[model samples]
Target: MVIVLSAGKLILTPTELLCRLSSGATLRALPDDIRLVTTPPLLIADAGAVSWTLPLDGVECLDDITEFYGFAKE
Candidate 1:
C-alpha cells in the first residue's frame, strides 16, 4: 500500500516505523484492539486511513529510521 503524505510523496509501508513517523502519523502504545504482529507494506491515504495487503501478525513497534529510500533525510 502507498499513502500520500503531506510532503507530496508516497508512504509504501504503513508498518514501517520510519515511514509512519516521517508521515507525521503518531505511533502510540499498542492498543488491545490493534496488534502489530507483522510489518507489512502499508498504504495510507492523505486523510489518515490505513490499509495493508499483507497480514500484520508479528509487529511490535516502529523504529525512528525504518529504511532510507528515495530522498535523503535532512
Candidate 2:
C-alpha cells in the first residue's frame, strides 16, 4: 500500500492500514458504543473512530526523496 506521511498527515492505503495493525501499533477507540473483542492493534476496525499515533521512523515517504537522481543530466 502507498502511505504518504507528508506535513504530519497520514495518507494510507487499505493494505497499509492492515499492515500497521498487524505490526502491533496502538489504536485509540474513541466514542463509547463501539464493541471490540481484542485490544490488540489488529482489532482496531472493530472499535469506533479508531485513532493511533504511529511513528513513521522506518516507513518511507517518497516525497522526502527523489526517485531518480541525476537522470536528466546523464
Candidate 3:
C-alpha cells in the first residue's frame, strides 16, 4: 500500500488494485482487467467498463504501483 496524506491510497495485490487516487475517487481493478499506464502526473486506469485518468502524486509512488501490476516501467 502507498499512502500519502497529500495523495491517497494505492493497494496492490497479485491480482488486484484498490486505488483511491488523489483525484478523490475510489477505484478498483484486477490484473489484465485493463492496461494501467502511468504518465508523470496521472494514472490511466480502468473502472468497470470505463476508463479514468486518476491523479497521482510522486513518481516513486507511481512506479511502485506499475511494477507491482507487472507493467513495464519507463
Candidate 4:
C-alpha cells in the first residue's frame, strides 16, 4: 500500500523505488510507514517512521484507489 498526495494538479508516482515529488525534490518511504492526517483541502502524510505532516491536496479510502493504478490482471 502506498499513499499519494496530489500536489496542485501534479501527481507523483514512483518508478521502481524512487518517488519524485517536484523538480529536483524526491522522497523515499516504505508503504507500511505511511499514515494520514486528514484536514480540509489538505491531507497530511506521516512516513519514514517519523512524526511529521506531509501536506497534500486530497485524500481517499484504500478501496477506491485501486482503479487509479489500473484494473487487476485476470
Which has the greatest TM-score? 3
Order of quality (TM-score): 3, 4, 2, 1
lDDT of 2 by residue, 1-74 (tens): 23433223332332223223444442333223122222221112234344433334331332221121111110
Q: By summed lDDT, which 10 consecutive residues of candidate 3 come out lowest?
A: 33-42
lDDT of 3 by residue, 1-74 (tens): 55563657777778777777568778877666545445565666666667766566667766676667767644
Cα shift from native, residue 46, model 3 (Å): 2.7
Q: In model 3, which regions exceed 4 Å deviation?
A: 21-25, 33-39
Residue range 1-74, candidate 4, lDDT tens digits = 35444532223243222344655566544433344334443323345354333455444532222233332211
Candidate 4 lowest-lDDT run of ten: 8-17
- Highest lDDT: which candidate? 3
**TM-scores of the models, in the order given:** 0.19, 0.22, 0.64, 0.40
Q: Which ten residues in a row have the lowest lDDT in candidate 1?
A: 56-65
Candidate 2 TM-score to native: 0.22
Error of 1 at 54 (Å): 10
Kindly list the per-residue Cα lDDT of model 1 for residues 1-74, writing each as its tens digit.
Answer: 44334433334343332234444554422121132222362322222354332222222211211232222122
> What lDDT score is found at residue 70 in candidate 3?
61
